[model samples]
Target: MQPTTPLFLQKFSSNAPESKELQRLTSFENVENKNRDTYLDMIRIFINRNHVYRRGHVEFIYSALKNMESFGVQKDLEVYKALIDVLPKGKFIPTNVFQAEFMHYPKQQQCVIDLLEQMEDNGVMPDYEMEDLLSNIFGNRGFPLRKYWRMMYWMPKFKNSSPWPVPSPLPDNIYELAKYAIQRISSVDVQSQITVYQTKEIESSIDDTWIVSAQAPSQKDLLKNHDLKEPVYVEGSFRIWVKDQLVNYFVLKRQPKQHIKTIKDDLDDVSNIRTPIFSFQKPIEKQVQVMQSVHEQEDGVILAVCATGTSTKDSLLSWIRHLEKDGNPVLSDALVVFTLRTGTREVATVNNVEQKQIESK
Candidate 1:
């Protein structure tokens, strides 16, 4: 949108506020600090610069949405509403039924829809104020408004449905993250306790990292009862996500418990009152109903779950040693095998100069 002039003046002033491309580049440069305040400031500047015609609001909004994660404000409710507020009021609302059904100002409508989608993906719940704002901008029947309505209907219902409550904006520290992951995985037992161990304590340890481990009292007893002849496993690098962050965890597991699944009769059937007409049918057999803990499910029983700071074989060895040092002394005599997907179990340990490694069989 630069006027006819010598190229020097165009480069000198750049007239950033007058041109969307220049303004976007200049605004991106100005946001060097890269935090929430600086992010909101850039949005305010864009709004002020193009307040009259708002010529490039769609493009600017798109650019802002793209940079939200870098500024650490993607899940911020206030930030999203601020982006929605950029569109001029009372302008894009469709007048006729036809205008509402077919996309009016398709590009702009699509842009707002994308913004709401980002919000939804980041789990940002919209408020009534945002609904009013959307109503003013695109009326009741706009496509984005429909998305907003759908979000309103479903998001709240699902927000608190999870039995395990994890904090919003998950912690950056890997230890704290490991605690959350272990706790979630260990929820099968109410008495499960989380213990933090230091690999440095193990004199011959090489990795020198921390381990956050979770184990229940019953699991400890199970380990105690396990036969020393059968080698239990130190397994995994299994991943679970905390928001956008991926955390890999390991588990100490044993062979699956051998048992037959008994098929039960339909307790709801009330044909017991029938007389000689059904005498030939087999009578209902009743026996003791023993409830088994979910831990005894078909797959291998998870004895313990831990997330190590360094996901190496040596660190896992330290984890096993720490468990033995704790109440589970049986692990010292029991054969604990490494079954990991990340890398080989062949690892060297250092006391000072002499190192020992477990060669893969």
Candidate 2:
């Protein structure tokens, strides 16, 4: 380095005491700024991560809080709420961040009520996972009667540790609060609400009625195969019904064995053939596995088709059980088909079986 020559240069150099102090201060400011940025980055990352992945990192919030020690506690709590607000429910449970935040500052319970009320007015429902998290925060002591009422009246049945008490003579303030909460929850996820509503509609329309049976052809050949043959027919019939409608009634007794394979292969395509029909998950698999036994005994696959009702599954199982109990031949060679809204049962089964959840689009 060149030797310091000018008077001003010497004053501003690192060797100067004032210059050294300024450098230290700058370094501290840079470190502080970096720490803040790190916390913000962590919050964004945690919120944006997939639900399944986030479940594995369940301690993310605790880790983040520990790391962000520089921020004020109150501000930290607000950040936590923001993060929770954006989280999706998957295999993991949702938290009632409203209650959790209130726990840290009991005075903020009103604030939680205000937020919940606001959400309800907007027509958004919180992700399902939020339930337990909220319970953990509010427990039995904090949430008032109004909060319990909103949860009971609006939210669908889900697991909760404590029994919710019925609120009688629900106050005017509580009514307003309930209204607000419903709107707000609906706004959080309109699509989820729509899906739930549509599912219920389908459920109500179908109810618990359904039937499963084998299909048969109209006529049979009396002559032997060696003789001049007449039109041949099989005796058994394959069909299912709900509300006595022939939505997915397919019967083929004298039909070629290849018909079973044909239908199975085209299940995805024929799925939309019938109106108001719902395909259960893995339709092909359901047909093959459920009808395997019937096929062995009769050299033909039995088909089960649901006509109308949410009880197609139960009905199919009942049909199988009835066959076993009555000494009737089990038709493992059968395929089950359901007629309902397009993809309703299939999607429901997928969500119910696999714990998949809706993500914000």
Please list the Cα RMSD from the true structure of every candidate, rounded to 1 decimal place. 6.5, 25.9
Q: Candidate 1: TM-score?
A: 0.78
Candidate 2: where are CA atoms >4 Å away?
1-105, 144-149, 155-361
Each prediction's Cα lDDT score?
0.80, 0.34
**What's each prediction's TM-score?**
0.78, 0.18
Error of 1 at 352 (Å): 16
Question: Per-residue lDDT for 1-361 in model 2, tens only?
Answer: 9764444234444344333533333232234554554455445544444343334233444444344445432233345455444333232222566644455334334445554554444323454444454554444445532474566566555323223222322344432333223333223222212111112223223234433232211111111111212111222223322111222322222222322442344545755554346644443343443232232224433222112123243333343333323322322222222222333321122112221233322
Please give the range of 10 consecutive residues that has the lowest summed lDDT in model 1. 346-355
Query: Which regions in candidate 1 have their CA more than 4 angstroms from the true location?
Result: 1-21, 24-31, 50-52, 260-293, 346-361
- In model 1, residue pairs whose N, Cα or C atoms come closer than 3 Å (at least 3 residues apart or on different chains), thus clashing, are none
